[model samples]
Target chain A: MKILAIISEFNPFHNGHKYLLERAKELSDCDAVLCIMSGGFTQRGDMCIMDKYTRAKHAVSGGADCVIQLPAPFAVAPAEIFAKGAIKILLSIPEVSALAFGCESGDEYEFFKAAELFIDESDNFKTIINKKLSEGESYIKSYAEAFEACGGNRDIVTNPNNILGFEYCKAILRAGADIDILPVKRVGAGFGDGELKDNYSSASAIRNNLTDIRISDNIPPYVYNDLKYSADLRGFHSFLRYSLFRAEPKDMQRIIGCGEGLENKLKSLENNNIEKIIENATTKRYSSSRIKRILCANALGLYADDTQNFLGADLYIKPLAVKKTRANEILAALSKSVYPVITDANGKGLSAEGEQCFDKDRYEFAVYNHINGTDKKDYMVLV
Target chain B: MKILAIISEFNPFHNGHKYLLERAKELSDCDAVLCIMSGGFTQRGDMCIMDKYTRAKHAVSGGADCVIQLPAPFAVAPAEIFAKGAIKILLSIPEVSALAFGCESGDEYEFFKAAELFIDESDNFKTIINKKLSEGESYIKSYAEAFEACGGNRDIVTNPNNILGFEYCKAILRAGADIDILPVKRVGAGFGDGELKDNYSSASAIRNNLTDIRISDNIPPYVYNDLKYSADLRGFHSFLRYSLFRAEPKDMQRIIGCGEGLENKLKSLENNNIEKIIENATTKRYSSSRIKRILCANALGLYADDTQNFLGADLYIKPLAVKKTRANEILAALSKSVYPVITDANGKGLSAEGEQCFDKDRYEFAVYNHINGTDKKDYMVLV
Candidate 1:
């Protein structure tokens, strides 16, 4: 019995995630599927409109064998760390044969090439890259230049999903895991776009559409219930709210990427204008795009110094569904597997440790929700 | 008439401000008082906890001839901008004689000495300060060292009020204003220590001590109505509940001061780990004390880029005691003033043109209140 492992935020479990799930099953040709879900926060630096458990239930209802948690930190982090953290949990499932993800590149050939260059850090490329950076070019621009110098194509680097996909590929390579990647072209609208068109619209667009009644076509059924349920979870936006109230100018100067003299410039603010302070503090010396990320991280209580290598038991098998007729077959396979399988997150298996782990993750996700401007009731989850 | 200009947040007219008011009166012997109050933000880089109108009312109730807004940008700024912004406003008030402030070295003589040295920015002292700052020492430390090196035998830099007092003097000298200095000793608990002793308690300590109690000895009688009247204006901790729910690792980077690549670290988190994120993110490079401020600022929607310049007005005073005899005194003052003053911010004063300006100021102040962890209602108010 081949088991497919998928990690997701689901947030509201829109068409994008739904499409990915269906495609994963088709490609892996697995009898059963496993999913590790994010509790509240998503990778894009905003709160999930829905709670993880509700989204998990949807995953099971929509078509999955089992559902577990990917935790909030891994869920909201950048593509590389997110992939590494999630993969760590998936690799533990002894029966899991493949790890599937939606890749923008449609194929792994170029993705792997880019990943190798980034990780290997070729000396010839580094010299040129450093020169561009010393000229006060943005890091993103510098990296883009490096990719060009290496004769790599630009189309792959410019796409958001492609970038993340490359990082995901690198993560798998670094892990030296046996699990294979099932790369597929993403079939959805891009993130942060204002409108929702096809069934698979971007999460940002879907959320924006959700605010008005007109965008219902973009979301799945029961999304309202899920949104209402997760309304109290207190996402990252609320964390920004908290951070704004508690921080001081002198204190703000200490965050990484804040830069020297930037604090003094920020300190020069007169209004309660957070955006202005950031604009004034950010200059050619520091790209606004990079600074924005650091600022968002600080607002959401995410920063660089907190790196950790703690990987709990390698395999985390969470059954989303168990056919009553085939229970015996699944049970036999579970018993013979070398990795531990978590049948019940609240009871047996990893429930004891998982419960404690999940609580902390949920709390942070709640703050993320608030900072993203979701209503208070919108963040709380029924689960 | 000789008028004394005072800059303040007056965030609820606490006793600390009252002490400063009385001291300014006695020291300057000014005929009138002109207070430049921050509308939305404060020096701590957070929003004010109350609306500017209510705060202005409290200021007027506590005692002031006129109250003008410091404007949003200057209100939420650091000490230098905050000081400079307020100074410009006070000096613009033609009747102003001097600026009175409270300092740790309640002794005027010592404060003046520090102020004189600080304003001179002598070559020798500047060199010493530059040398110390280059070594990564804190500005406070650098200032103290430089002051001593300048042949000034004062070690009052660590004192919060004295430090501000010196900056205020510096701002005056820099502006070449005719205003003199009136320094009074602080007679309250220190800032952010959470200590409470009789009537002498820091605002932070008072708030902490009042945690669950409806009323406390520390709160003034006049401001009691405000606490009683306002409905559930969520506090910073409560907002954190909302923020964590929405924010992702990337969102944390958007807040001012989240640094050290901590955003990526927090992205690895799961639910309910807000406290852990704070603990993990803080280190030798980032202190918990500073992080708290950043967290608060983020929650309030106050960003470094949003800083504004008030030009001169900090607030447009609206008298709360219209029925009392003080109304005549206030009305008389408003009629003769060059800048327009509002009696009712919401009802009579908010014309289309006035509304535009008021909205801008109120919007900025609202953001500030978010940072200060105070409940704000009715963008424009009658106070």
Candidate 2:
């Protein structure tokens, strides 16, 4: 069987995500799709507008065969580390044959070449990058300049998919994983663009569309009703800024990519605009993306340094919805399967071991519950 | 010395409200403006966005001289009863010569006449209203029909300001107060338009605008700055709905005016949209406005159906702003003022009496905090 692993935030799984799942299945021709989704906080420091289990269940409903959690630390860490953590876990499963991801530029050869250049960190390239960084430009800018200085094309770094896709390949290469990298061209919408079009929609646009009842029609049928129901229930990112501001200066420092002095700047900016807050706290040495991840981590309570211990790379398939016969078949196969299966949450109360197995999932669910004003129990059960 | 009594919610007092206060002062030629603001909930069931004292302090900082809290039961009751609660308190003070208010139509006479007719109940108005309600029209439509049937102008009741102003006048007459009604024309913006425009903005618009950094220009300087700081603090209302939904159904039924199985409807909507949840629970006989009050009360920790006690109009004059020297002037006047002066709260913490006072204020603060994301301490303090 050609098994494939897909990684995502799936903050609140919607139709676009469903489409990605279908496309990944078609492209990889995998027997089953396994998703490693972020818990609690997302990359941008925004709380996963919905809880992760809700998102994970939605993933199952959207067609994922199983769902496990990306531990909090890497989930909100810098792209390189986030990629490292996710890749390491997937590679642990010797049976996993491929890794499929959505990227801006869908050219696998181009992305892999770029990844090779970044991973090799050739001496001349490193020298040029250091020289550019001394001039106080952001890392992305420095990287582009350095890439050009080294007689390499730098345009790939500018494309959103190329950047992430390159990082995924580098992580796989660094880990010595035989798992193939499958870069699928993102369909439909571009990131940071406000307009919604076709089958492709940016997660940002989808989140914005949720403020009104009318936009509920654009989401998939399975999630449409629930999304509308959740949207109507509460404000989105309503407490994000507040959570960041209220953090103890020490706690703020512990956030991913938020260095020592960054806390002082952030503390001083407690009374400033969100733009000023981000700018004042960020350093030239760090990329804007890094700063954003830090802010997002702070706001979402995903302090990276505090999340060191990682769950092992065992598959935990949470069946959101299954045919009764299929469920029975899957349950029977669990004893013979390569990894331990998590069909139910150890029945209601979580055992310490069970909680350890599912800490990331539980935290993500709690955050979602907090955001939507629902009890944590709402996201726990499968049936 | 002209002293004007303005009954208000001042829920998270913002720039538009500052305009109203300045306009009221100019119209009444009053040196001292006595604001009787709602505490926990409003006529609508939604929370006050901030605690009453915080809002009162903001109002005082903007313009008002003395701020007294309207009890929660009356504050969240129906328009007629809320007006009665406010009028009774205002009437308790003989020095409160002019009662100033904002009216949408800019016509006080029409509203006053309509109020007089309604209060007289001259021609079997109840039967006529019931008949119209049985036909499935909205309660507002039934109200308009009833007014037309009773030899009264329906046009007056259709105007939002006119309706509220009419209720204020009716309460004053019903209480047999000697205070004169002074209705001022509303300016700049309208309420519930679901869009932000001009200097005159609805509280909702002001809140929505706060979510986007670009809209900061529309807010007054102090208000905008305070809100920006507050948003980074914590999710103030994060657990509000959860607490309400988890409360016993019987306890929900105990809320004032929560009649005709509304509690059951609310129980079923534990995880639904906030607006839809409220709307479904609202009956033609019991307006959404009234139901909203009860829901808000439940969130604020007020027991059901405690509307019978007047709570003795505790604490006549709270100093919102002292101006250092103006403090002595207000203190001198309060010493001779007829109503009992309340300088300190009798309880230590959020005791029954303190909860009664603070819950309403906290409820309003919660709404404001939800919008602006400010820390509880960031709100302006009442002396």
Candidate 3:
């Protein structure tokens, strides 16, 4: 009863994600694959092109045995926090023997070394990072510089997938998790690539050309059907504008990631063209991704204290979809989990901490449902 | 130098509004007509069908010599507060000698009697009203019943315009302002009428049938052109849904109108259709209009303390438009106002109290502009 866990967004469950799932299962020699997918929003702070349940169903159809939702506070967050939440959930399951991830650099040894350097946070490395940060460099840039200075590969630390992969390793070590690491090399298009290349197109490429007929060749048939009524960040510009306009500076200060007068900066932005507003708010210290995460947090009213409470509390496993044939096995394995397993959307029998996280997740989904004008219930998908 | 003041919403300056203006001017025998109109929202807690600047331009084109904006906190409020804010603005100006309003009864003596009773708040009347409220009647209904019991005409107290006219009288007495009251008889259609009749149609009727060519016969040609790009509450459904979904019970409690656990009721509602949500939230204790006002206040994040502060502070005179022929005369008259006159949208040289209200007004307009995707400047519209 060995389960290999993968952390992913699965924004649309495309060919590239299917390939990685299959590769990871083969490499880890696991009985089943469990995916911890971002629920309503992605790490880049954009709402998923498709809702989480539909994406979970597509994941099961593609190859995964089960798909569990990563709550929005973690889903639409920085790499470290995202990895921390997913790793915490995977560690709670006693049967999860290995954690797999897709990355540009397949060298697990380099990842472990980088993860160690970050975990220890030596005084010298901290001093260098702080100096770079003081000079107004972005956090990622400062981290990469400090990693290179400390005799680590800057390329491995700077690449998006590799950064997330190492953050997962750091979280696993920090949590004292007894699991194996499996790194699968990403194929075809790069992480940031926005064009279809063969059958393994990036999710962004598919999303940008969602209406293009060629997209049918990239995603599963079910995913294509689900995407017919998908939503995007642009569709929520009015909501974002209203949220930002209504929030005072003090209110903005309470939102996660809005610090150091960022509230004033965001409030000063012109309320026209979401892209232009984001572009104007981006600075050397605050990357576009960071600003976007802040904007999404503000729109959803995700407070900093609430997110911190969620991070400090134990996570509950809430599966979005399970393969029909493997549902019994997955449920049996999850029964031995140290954390609570939420089988119902009403979230009965949850601890206070778990209830807080579950409530936020429900609220985020409610907003998504409202925007799409759908009453799609949060029932578990069987495929 | 005599100036006749009218407090209006004029969601769209229709034939009825034009008739009222002419009749009020004739009754007051004043040299100029001054209209203090709601800015972005109306008393019923809905966004105006057109932007305030465009509506002000239409008002000037119809008959008003000057149109001053009523800030959002007071604009989307109950009759008593709405009248209080408008009267305060009118009282600040030295030249405004008479306040005129359209009413069904058109009896100045009756309005004065009702105003005196409300201002006095006799213990017997209070006990009756409280008992009715305790029995689950709405505030308006309870007030009407109590007025009828106290030897007042129930019809006069219940009629929308007459109620507002009496409230205006009450506000004038409370402020001890030296202004005369003039009641103008309404014609053609009733205040709540939803159909076009002859040339004088209610603003709601014109709004409900905006695309109908018959509306052109009810409103002026310029207003018809503005209706081509008008916005309604339906257009703001997404923003409202998003705001409510994201707000916590505590956050809803702070909104001006969401009191007595109404926040919990609102938060518990299904976030589907805006109209359906409001309908479901309505009860004997909360009328449809009250719930709509609460929703609008929640959407705009209008807090109770902030609104109370605005009410207590002296209101500023911010004219949205002025007839080109009467610009000099109106500006000269406004110069003698005890409250500050804000000619610039940037609101320079304003007191702290004035600045807070002005900031809220700008934020509300920014949300409106964001929804319409227009950048119409707030310059004075000279007709």
Residue-wise C-alpha lDDT for candidate 1, range A139-169, written one tens digit per residue? 7788878987896655567777677667667
Which DockQ-derived CAPRI band holds candidate 2?
incorrect
- Model 2, stretches more than 4 Å misplaced? A9-30, A38-42, A45-64, A67-78, A104-120, A134-138, A145-156, A186-234, A241-249, A258-300, A311-340, A346-360, A366-383, B1-239, B242-383
Name the weakest run of 10 consecutive residues (lDDT summed) in model 3 chain A. Answer: A232-241
Model 2, residue B45: C-alpha shift (Å): 12
TM-score of each: 0.48, 0.51, 0.79
- The deviation in Å at residue B299 for candidate 3 is 2.4
User: How close to the true structure is residue A367 of candidate 1, measured as C-alpha lDDT?
Assistant: 49
Against the true structure, whose lDDT is highest?
3
Query: Where is the poorest 10-residue window by lDDT in model 2 chain B?
Result: B230-239
Residue A123 lDDT in candidate 2: 94
Rate residue A345 of model 2 by lDDT: 43
Q: By TM-score, rank the candidates, best first.
A: 3, 2, 1
lDDT of 3 by residue, A85-137 (tens): 88888888989999888889747777888888877878889888999999999
lDDT of 2 by residue, A1-383 (tens): 45678888875676667777888888886777777788656666556655666677778777876666666667777777777777766665665778888777646666677777777789988888888789887778899887766555576677765676678888887777787878777667766556765545677777777765544544666666667445222243333444554568888877766756876766666544456666776665665556667666765556654454443334343333333323454344333444444545452343453355466555455545545656655222342
Best candidate, TM-score: 3
